[model samples]
Target chain A: MGAPEPLPARFAPGARVQVRRADPPGHVRTPWYCRGHAGVIERICGSFANPEELAYNRDGLPAQPLYRVRFSCRELWQDYAGNAGDAVEIEIFQHWLEPA
Target chain B: MRSHHDMGGRPAGKCEPSEHEYELWEKRVDALMMLLSDKERQLLKVDELRRNIESLGADAYDRMGYYERWMHSICQTLIQRGVISIDELGRKMAELEARDGRA
Candidate 1:
């Protein structure tokens, strides 16, 4: 069967959120550059099975909400030598985010 | 800790983009991926393939090309899932090597 329906969203569009900095062993999709950084939710990209669990051949039930979070370039890079308005958008899962 | 594959924003040299025609084996690997991950089969997942690639260690990761890594991961994942046995793979490789006469 196809993936289950997306889980209900927790944070709405434009909500502030931060990526959790935890680094557990095993497969993960969250990039290291975006962790522990604050950003605004650009949009919800629907939910899907957790990649970490899927990597281990397990059924990732209760799919987590996914979001395209927009972060300032300066926030992600200390010396971003670019425009102040420059930003990067990354797809993050609900389990990796916390209200900021 | 950051995995070796997660190199975003890290210090790096200029990125020189280039493209070339994919070799036959590369295309075959792509087809294998599509077939293995097809809905009816469900023998492998894209996530599992990526996890295996990431776990290939820094040395092999840098040494192998993109499709090379994918092929390696496909074999590794199939073995991990008990879809293929190591002895079967070894025998096949040996047979091919003997037929090819170490070329």
Candidate 2:
């Protein structure tokens, strides 16, 4: 079984948050593209077991809240040639986000 | 180690259209991987499976197709977890190949 109970979600939908810039050497779920990128929480995906610990065969204690953060492509890619209206989205853990 | 599977934005390649059908072994591999993750089996979590697939070296990672990656990862995972011994797996594989040879 996972954490006795799912951790209460910290961020809510439409909340502005920034992805923490980090280069963890171990197994990480945060995608490098979205690192240090500011985005809005599109939605709070259901909490899931912490993959970081699970990768090492450790018991992923309390589950972590996951959020679907959406970002504009132009901001994510310095020279993104796609349409100006294009955007990118990725699921990030609560631990990786800080108030912008 | 930071694996190549994290292709997030570091890329400059055009996406290729799939023009071929799934070979029989590929389809079977897909189904078998799903079964391993079943609640009853619990041999591997989907995330662990992903990590295993990403852990492959650059050569095997690029040389193999999508399902081939899954097959490779699944085999390694089962073996690492000690759920299925190598000898048992080899015997089953040989049986399967012999059946195919006769067909």
Best by lDDT: 1
Instruction: Give residue A99's error in model 1 in angstroms.
Output: 0.4
| Residue pairs with backbone atoms closer than 3 Å in model 2 (clashes) | none
Per-candidate local distance difference test: 0.93, 0.85
Q: All candidates' TM-scores?
A: 0.95, 0.86
- The digit string of per-residue lDDT tens for model 2 on B64-95 reads 99998888778878888888899999999999
Error of 2 at A23 (Å): 2.1
Task: Tell me, by DockQ, which candidate is best.
Answer: 1
Give the C-alpha lDDT of model 2.
Answer: 0.85
Scored against the true structure, residue B77 in model 1 reaches a CA lDDT of 97
lDDT of 1 by residue, B1-28 (tens): 6789988987789878988899999999
RMSD of 1: 1.9
- Give the TM-score (0 to 1) of chain B in model 2: 0.80
DockQ of 1: 0.83
